[model samples]
Target: MRKTEGLLKLLSLCLLAGVLVAGVLFPVVGAAGVASNQASETVDSMSSELATDPPPLVTNVTDSAGNVIATLYKQYRIPTAANQINDAMKWALISTEDRRFYDHKGVDWKGTIRAAISNQTGGDTQGASTLTQQYVKNYLINVVNRENPLGQEKAQEQTIARKLKEARIAIQLETKMPKDQILAGYLNVVEFSHQIYGVGAAAKAYFNTTPDKLTVPQAALLAGMVNNPIMYDPWRKPDNAMHRRNLVIDRMVDNKKLAPADAERLKTEPLGVVEKAPDKPASNCVGAGPENGFFCQYVVDYLLQHGMSEDELFTGGYTIKTTMDQRANDEAKKSAEAQVKKNQPNVANTLSLVKPGKERHEVVALAANRDYGLDKDRGQTTYPLPSGVTNVTGAGSSFKIFTAAAALKQGVAGINSTIQVPNFHISQVFTGGGDQCPPKDRYTRTYCVSNATEGGSGAMSLQTALATSPNTAFVILEEQAGMGPVVEMASKLGLRNSMAGNAATGGPVDPDNENAQFRTSQTAWYGPSDNSPGKGSFTLGVSPVSGLEMANVAATIMSGGVWCPPTPIASITDRDGKPVPYKEPACEQVVDEGLANSLAVGMSKDDMPGGTSHAAAAAARWTRPMIGKTGTTQNNGSAAFVGATPQLAGAAMVFRPDSPNGGLYDRGPGNVVAARGTNGDMFGGKTPARTWFGAVSKILEGQPELPLPPLDPRYDRVGRR
Candidate 1:
């Protein structure tokens, strides 16, 4: 009986021992279960969040033909798929990172235990994390950085809690994603170096090859970089990279993925790293290639000003197809460079081309001689647009077309309307007929107009006056047409003042003035204003106007009075190849078609003998019929030529930025005459005209001749008729 009682006591003690062990293990199992649940929830939440918002992608700007012109990116990552990756690369990565990747669900308990023992024993550290766990950690870090930047430090902290969360999330991820897909996502997002992420980017950056083209050694090198990219950057530390690469090869051999002989051969071989400098993608127009910089910048400015979201432009992977003609842009650059070479280095020139069409008014080419940059010494800003080196120069006599249009629109005069040619005119209040000077000091009678020369006299047809660009005759027409109508015509034709008020009207409305009601109609000039000289001389192109606007004006006439606002973009698409809606061209009929055609006819006369731009037309010798006007600002401070065929309208300008009010004639370096004229001074009909002709000649190459509309016979009167 005593023996039986002792055996029972021993059995009870054994039972107690079993219960203690069970008690110890139960909490661990429960804790693991709770942790796993938390991870699953976290992963579910993360997956939901990611489904709604993907990472920012690089935006690409392409030409009309879909050739990539520029790339814009916030992070230089180009994701690649798992199937697209080379077998060698996949094996190398798997062998180096997690040999048992296929066997484990998410956490490698055996490897983790081994790593824990190694850590305690002060042995070489081994990464116990599986590929999925690593991906989960990276995903968590990315989410934390994106959603809660302030918690990034805590997210990256090497703590037990973080590891447990990673393992749990990894398990959830394994259940939700295919193993190959998880590998692809991890490969795509893993950072290989500064500004370089993903196997695709790293492949291109280091070997100048695609992921699928990566050789065994190259793949091994890249796979090894995931541990510490900075330390093993092949470009910076070739020796360290070589050593790490060999280690990867050794691991691949041990994993039985690579033949022993092949592995040894690759280990002895050079890294074969072909270091290609990553293309630091340009974010703005200023960084576009030299030939495309200014034009690109113009597009950027246009989009930004037209309500495009700035963030979207930089990171939304938008595909913008611009209207820029690569051929025209190239020719324009050559022409501008040739013209700029003839003047002082500081002298800036601009050329703008616009295609006139019923569907869209496209700015085909915008080119300047210099590159776009921040250096003031070298012109950076696009010359045609307002910049430190350029502002709106007076449109000069090119403003006469507006006056001519106004007269025709108001029926105040026709092409046959006659005005006796005179050396000058001083008037108090303009009456369409003759110059009438009011008594001196009347403030209202302040009109003084003069011609460039004194020659033709007595009853010249208005057409002849315009062809000759007679300042006195246009001023007379402006008086006859009434300043209100003349100003209205200019405004409707897309003239914008860079100053505070309308370009046509000098400034803000004077509440006390009788014409306060008229202020609403005058808003088209584009630059800072000089004090308004209340006189008819305004028709002489005294107001500051950009070349772009001038080109638009010419294009309007070319379009037979239909004003299509200038646009540089042809189409825009999102990253997913979906079209994004944008504003269509704002079209308006600004003048009578017949009136515009008649004015075009008169302007074409400038290409005839004795016309203002006749010399320029002769120089161009275009196969197609062309019409153009020459403009010389008062004191010869600026010179311009605006011309057009039925297909295209363009403007060219030459001005001194420092001494804008000073003459462009004989003022260039070495007394180089910028505007060749009769009196050894620059004239609008000379250099500006020649430059426009040169540029147009190249632009019209291979283009079929299209004639302007026939002149309305109602106003076909000629000189002295």
Candidate 2:
């Protein structure tokens, strides 16, 4: 009887202490209620608030095909046998947060009183949270909701009304949802740092394993992260996170949830942080650099801006079929590189002429190269200067390819038409200039004719002139055809911007403009006219062009006038392997098959013995046949080449910008710097050709090289003869 009475007194004291702790921790009372009388009312009010609002609805994720990727919820309800939510979260939370959770109906009055006494006496720290209360807080309450990118914002720490509300919600949830569901929800919605939102993501992120694969120690560590996700991020700060995890394990052992031996073993266990590559593409491919695949990059940029995603590019698994064969594209780059290297040494030296401090080395080199001849390390020679000059511009001679096409299209010239080269000149009526004279001047030298009326000449068929790339001969033809037909033809050939015979610096050739500075007569055929002022003959290229744009244009020509947008990926399928809709294959013809063939055949002369491209002509040694062209601009020391096998086509060009460098000073400035330089010159036939050859040879290892088709039989020399 005496022992029983003493036990009863101990129980009464514990209960009293719990109540006092609760009173001090949460003192707010309901209206019209005095202390103890209002306790139930306060609890009821809290419960009602929690019941009124549930968590927000989560968003769904999808795949490229618009198929359901994942139906995301804060918590996953699936239950695993051994890896049950109870074992994973462990008993640490229950003992530390809620000692009497299972024993109490909804609230633990005894624990609450014990906590109150501890607070008053300063004997032990006190907190009134039950297991259910903590669970509710983890999943339902907004207590841990963060407002910053990182979860450093503190939640409202003290709230009587909030605590009361938490209690009510806990009871309601326990009554409404199954025990397993409540546990699952809490685990699914918990935050573990580094954007990991659920137990599954956290498991994979921290341990490189799944929830079902976690050990007791790993589980305990995860449980400790609930209080502070960042400070306890296992992968980032393992030492701190491990300490917290060990604390939880200690608590579980004290509460009898874990064996003493197991606890001791777990304490010494090494933490293993899983290594996971980010779920994005590796950013170190050819697509990521300045020297990326120039042609490929342009196509990709166009597709992206016009409408396409990175996913579609790499993983969509679509097959992209282009007009040009990959083998051909490779050949083009190799040939260009090889051709450019041969002349680069000379060009580089000319560019380096001026000493570093002599002026800007490049400027002096450029000015020096333009004025006098360059003495190459190999040998010294003076080269011819191109017509009227200033700074380098696009190649004017090569621009005639389009001119010839336009003339043929307008019926002004036929492949067999023969014209005499004379003092070819365009009158003011033709040039739109204030005065007109035979397009002849002091600068006029190569290919200039005195006059049809004066003593001068060279007679050749239109095909022959195109084959030889003659300037004076074409100017006479241009005068006979008139500018209107020529201008219209240029537009059809895809020339968006035009240049009049005379135009201001940077002005497009506008026929309607009465006054133009670029105006030149028949002599302008080879390049810039002698009298007109400008610079290097980069004009032989007709202005700068990107490798990609040129590639596409060449594709159109090679495809017999068909142009199509380039695509890297062939297709995109859903997670379940369903196909998605995208742009259908688009192709359109831009030229007549005959015209393309004519141009191809004409360009082939460079490979013939009396032709300009002797080095490329050496392909005669190989089993396959190749065709190429050599181009040099007068004013600017620039060189260019374009070539194609039946399977591929590409263009490559090299020119000094503004001035030469310290290296090339020994060379005279301008085209003169490279004038005496021959097919062996740096720009025209060497480096660019080598690059094109190397790239193509590798790609065409096992492939057969085919010859181009003949031009229209009606215009063939054999037929005419």
Candidate 3:
């Protein structure tokens, strides 16, 4: 007996050694021995044990007041805990998918053996996958898709090798998570239709209800869809869906999860599916609210440009709070729409409001008159047209504020300084190397400039010239200050020269290229173009700038020369509600308070009686001090009004793209009539100014009245006369 026992022990040791050798030789192969080479590779790459990581959830975007403006989702999913899900749905899924789910480890070997026998006996193919196995499969699929996009298709194939790998992962997942947690994850990651994934989304899509609110019939119907969602979609095949739902109800009754009477009653009920999939959940800003769509798009574009990847944006559940005040945004939109309706239907209008903050420049409102869509004829462009950090349009005369600021800063002129103004011509004053004229007049040593009104030229103070918006006065001022200083000053004030130049090209320009040179001379009026170096016209507002930029310019003055690059985002929080790192607003004192105050006085004069924007001032009916500039581009191609108060600043612009030379005046007869409106001719002080007033008045309705700072004593006497 002792000899026999020793021999058995020796045999057992040899067998154990042989098993160890096999494990060492084939480490990737699972114990099931059915895993494919690809599955072996996948298992070898993963941890020894797998853990459940929930899929991505929807991100929420809120306005300044913390009201949800939009919900951005990659899969339109809203995750719910296992307890939060409807009880009926949970039971139904278990009954139909895995009756022995609660009793199994992970693989349900008895069911697998039964399925194998049935298949061997010529019976229909059966699925023996436990709920845990299904969860593991879905999780692995997501992991593969995210980590190895090229191998995703092969990873999803329904082969014995894939099944064995799924079983191994399922056992590991079960060891790491509770049964209820596994069930919840499975429900959350399973696809119900093409873009519809997760039980929460499925409930909403099928019945327009939340997961916890699903009724017995609805629960059963959805539970039945897990096997073959497309084949049993109630929306596509009601009859097939009804049959599947009945089977699930029957299984629930058999498993004693539902009373036979209750099951019978549920079976009798009709599938109350929604008429249409709940307006296929929008994947991006294209589906944002009509009022918030453009702003949302702007936010999206901003994030993408700032190094946030598309995958991260879609998957990361970021909580974004923007600087937009919904009230201001609404008012701006209304004002823009009203102006568009009044003018030619095709003409575009944009209104933007900005305000100063301690840490950043706030974009309170960004509004346009068109819908945010892909239909070109219906005005689909995300208008106000973002240039770089802000939007862009022809600055026209609105740009004179920059030139005026530059002159004051350089001490080349003051609000009281006298400058010769020409009634409609100043070709003789700007005769120099950079003062080259159009090719037709190349040989002429003249660069004639004009005022919007005839017989309005003469000796005028810089303040009066600003209030009147005389093109010749500013051109002469630009020459005196030198284009270099003017351009440099504008740059310091957040006017990206390259972006401004690109705005003149009439096509989309790369906002990312800081060194991109301005290419077209026609739009050069929008900005100083390298191609057209004689920027004597720079002071005349020839460069294009967005309404937001103009508003920022005004905001800079309001902030006493502190230029804070405008930012829409107020705060960003990650999934755990922790602040994410982002670039802080770069605030710089670009101009002296004295110079800014002097310019403010000039703009304030424009809104006073006899000033060019007097009509707008009247319309605004402001009770507090306000300063503004009115701008009408050459040939009336565009009209703009930029204004600032102690508390707020805004800009409005109207463009006539189809008009002759893109002039607002040459817009169709309807536009001409709407813009003229018994005012004789459309000017910057008319439509654009009025639009700004109409919107801003509403925005400032309840705000406390604040007065602008007193002008610097040195220049107080210059423009007052």
Identify the candidate with maximal TM-score: 3
Error of 1 at 498 (Å): 5.2
Q: Ten-residue segment with the worst summed lDDT in candidate 1?
A: 524-533
TM-score for all models, in order of appearance: 0.79, 0.51, 0.85
Q: In lDDT terms, which candidate is top? A: 3
Kindly list the per-residue Cα lDDT of model 3 for residues 630-687, writing each as its tens digit.
Answer: 8876656667888888878888777654332434434432343343255223467877
Ranking by lDDT: 3, 1, 2
What is candidate 2's lDDT per residue for 1-721, written digit by digit as tens? Answer: 9999878867876666554444433423333343454555555554454343333222222222232222323322222222444464645545445556566644565665566556645577776766566666654433235333232222234444455555555665566655445445556555667645556656666666677677777788877887788898776787998898888888888888888898989889876666542121112122221111332333344345456665344323232322223333334423433333323443421111001111111000011122222334532223311111211334334455555655565566666677555445443323212133344345343322222134334686766665555556666665555545554443333332222333333333454554443432322322333443222222234453322223233444445545454333333443335665555345545567676566556556655565545564365243455545555555335554555565555444455433432234433233323222344354444443434444544555677877766776433432342
RMSD of each candidate? 8.1, 15.1, 7.0
Give candidate 2's root-mean-square deviation (CA, Å): 15.1
lDDT of candidate 1 over 531-592, digit per residue (tens) = 43234656777655667777888888888888987788999998788998865547888787
The per-model lDDT (C-alpha) reads 0.69, 0.46, 0.71
**Steric clashes per prediction:** 13, 110, 14
Runs of candidate 1 with Cα error greater than 4 angstroms are 1-45, 49-54, 106-130, 133-172, 279-287, 342-344, 373-390, 427-447, 456-459, 482-484, 496-537, 657-682, 713-721
Model 3, TM vs. native: 0.85
Candidate ordering by TM-score (highest first): 3, 1, 2
